[model samples]
Target: MTPPPEDLASEDAKIPAPASPDALRDAILSVAAGDADSFAGLYDATSARVHGLVLRVLRDPAQAEEVTQEVYLEVFRRAAGFDPARGSALAWILTLAHRRAVDRVRSSQSQSDRDVAYESRANTQEPDPTGEAALATLEAQRVRTALEQLSERQAEAIRLAYLDGLTQTQVADRLGIPLGTAKTRLRDGLLALRRIVSAPRQRKEE
Candidate 1:
């Protein structure tokens, strides 16, 4: 992973806007043809946008910067496959950044969930089978009711991600939408479900 730059604040103001579409297309073609120097120019022209999109998705400067580097490496390796008729170079680059950032977020969430589950199991006493079954049934019903409160798209994203064990990318692919849209649905759905689940607890405490 690339380390976050020490002078990012100072450099951000100096970074110019992205190159023209024609210029970027030419640069990508040059890079595809083995011109390493063109890769530098392409990075300069689009790195800010790439990093910004990644940061927006990741909300972590260090991780965004690292993933931004990974996106560029992917771009360089796959530049030959870029078709100008399909889309502009910048769009393609940003799409790659978004996918990579989403992947990183999912990977972090999976690890965190695993750690929490492990700790929970370790601290738990021997199960009371009857009591456990009753609690589990109630919890499942509550969750199902909460899920029904979400919009169809939001609920679908949550189901694919949590129940089907699919990544955000997979959810996007399954729904025939972009990865960013899938992420938004999942995030919004989770927030809504959180509110629904906590309402009873708040009422009980009141």
Candidate 2:
């Protein structure tokens, strides 16, 4: 069976020490042409420095190790894109390592920010029993104040029809009044309630 592509760099990975700048550049160019032996030589020449740079930026040994493997794989794939005329081969490799490490840091931070925002929204939207009770108390006060302005029969009709959930005909029967008279009392009571509710706001605006 054929070994994995990563094993290609594993063969002579630790066989040789570091190479000179020109020799490393030559090896990188050879690896660009599909030379597995030269890639192993290139890995031997720069893997330590690349791993160290990644470790320093990431600050986690396990994550650094994972990123180091990714950097070498990137080097294997992008060796052909290197331009010696622009810079040395080691400089190109270190650039790849640093960029990968910083990207991981940024991705982790972004995920953390999203988690915090979701938690904040969840807490804000949760129902509050105290606040709901306070709102109900304020509404009851408004209804009581509006009823004071209505006639006794009108107030009684509205309470039976709306607050007690009675039908209009039932309100008329309970009060011993006609259906039309009950409807007229409910309508007048509602108009008076609207006027009383709006009075506070209109006064504030004026």
Cα lDDT of model 2 by residue, 21-137, tens digit: 799899988876666667666766787877777777788876776677567656765777899997777778877887888878887897799689878787656445678579968
TM-scores, in order shown? 0.51, 0.50
Put down candidate 1 lDDT per residue, 19-96, tens digits, no spaces. Answer: 777999999898776665677678778878788778867888767766775676567657878998987777677777
Global lDDT of each model? 0.72, 0.71
Candidate 2's C-alpha runs over 4 A off are 1-17, 123-206
Choose the strongest candidate by lDDT: 1
Supply the global lDDT for candidate 2: 0.71
Candidate 2 to truth, TM: 0.50
The segments of candidate 1 whose C-alpha lies over 4 angstroms from its true place after superposition are 1-16, 122-206
Extract clashing residue pairs from model 2: none
